[model samples]
Every structure is written in C-alpha cells, then in structure tokens.
Target: MVNGEFYRRYLNLPDPYGQQETSFTMLFEFREFEGKMYLKYQREEDTYNLFNKTTNAIILKQSFMKELFVNNVLPHQTHAPDATMNMNRSVEGQAKPYNEAFWKYYNAPVETARDSQILKALSEMESKP
Candidate 1:
C-alpha cells in the first residue's frame, strides 16, 4: 500500500469531469475522535494519470484531515445562485489563495522545502499568462 494501511473501506468513484470512463480510486482510514468517527486519512488515485503515457507512474492524491469538532450546527449555502458547484465548493470560497495565517491557526502541517519549491514554480507559471 506504499507505506500506508489499506484495511479500511476503499472506493472507486466516477470522475465527474472525466471522459472515457475515467474514475478516481480512493482509500480511506477512519479514526474515533471524541467518541465519534471521522476521516483520518485518504489516498486518492488521480484519474488523469493514464497508462497510455510514456511515464510508468501513478499519482496518488492524499489528504489528512484533522482538527475536527462536531458543531451540530446546520450549514447553509452562501454561494451565488449562478454557482456551477453543488456541494464541492467550500464556504465563501476560502479554500483558494492559500492564507498562511489561517493554516497556522488551524495547526495544519507546514509545507516542506520541496513543497514550497513546487508551489513557487507553479505560481510563476500561472503568472505568465
């Protein structure tokens, strides 16, 4: 499992944006926190990584969710009526434009040197056009 556990439930979900029957394969691990279960870790296969490519490699998208608290409060949408996303969009679109302060406050793991370098390169490329 590539340095990870696979005893948990695994899912093969259809990629909404994909054509040619592409799908995303996900592996999830759950943990009990405060007497309730929550997603501890998830590993998702990138649907775009095709076997037809010259490179014999697969990209796995992994996410580690933490600092979860049961609010018991109902969530209401604040998105515009013309929104293209249903439930995928985060509240107020705060997911983008990475905020250092927000991540630090939430105790998110700090990015390593390799991560920073990759982000810097992507930012430079995006800024070009």
Candidate 2:
C-alpha cells in the first residue's frame, strides 16, 4: 500500500504525523561462489496502482507470482583488474542495446492485466483510419 492510512484504518490505529508514502521497492539476491559473493540481480518493480474492490467473498481478480531457481552458475567477470563484478546493468529507464547474449537468454515476466489493456489500446489506436 502506498499510503499507510489504509492499513492504519484496517488495524484501528492512529495516523502518524508527516508520514510520506513510497511506491518504490528494490529486491536483491546474492550467492557465494569460490569464497566470494556475487549479486544475481537488483530489480525495480513496475507497479499499477489501480485497485478494484468487492465487499463479498474472496476472489482472484488479479495476481502476479514468480518462482525462480538457479542451480547453474553464470559467468562472473570483473571490470577492474582485481575486482570481481557479478552483474552490471541499468536498473531502470529505456532498454538499451547491451548484453545481447544475456538479454536473448532472459525470459520476460508474464504479461499482467495492465499489460493486456495497454496492448489492446495500442492495437485499437493503430486500427484508426
């Protein structure tokens, strides 16, 4: 939840003074290999903040889930002569023509409801005379 007010109301708690809500998060995973630590990935989440609610029974209206398992280790290279670099890339912004091999091998996340809406809108726009 962006604003803590919703949760506070649900939990029957008073609002905190000057509490600014954040809609950003980052997750990281690391592994140790050859007595050295290497980061798997540091990713920023893309969020759609629209919520459709109902007052009845529980229903699976929307969901996003991902399960990952890494058994084989990747090539760990270092930019520095002595430093070890695990992974390198921009966390956000436009996709660049970099790491073609890695990007080719990478599988994108499953399309969400928001993604479907966007695609449909684009298709409709393109169909306009």
Cα miss at 121, model 2 (Å)? 44
Q: Can you write out model 1's per-residue Cα lDDT over 1-129, one digit (the tens) per residue?
A: 334634333343453221222344657777676676766665555333322223434334343322323334223537555456443654345235878887776866789999999999999999996
Which segments of model 2 are wrong by more than 4 Å? 1-3, 6-22, 46-129
Against the true structure, what is each candidate's TM-score?
0.29, 0.29
Which runs in model 1 stand beyond 4 Å of their true positions?
1-18, 48-87, 90-96, 101-129
Instruction: List clash counts for every candidate, in order.
Output: 0, 0
Writing each residue's lDDT as its tens digit, candidate 2 over 1-129 gives 535542211112232212212234557788888887776555554322222233323222222333233456655644444333222433223244689788875887889999999999999999999
The number of the candidate with the highest lDDT is 1
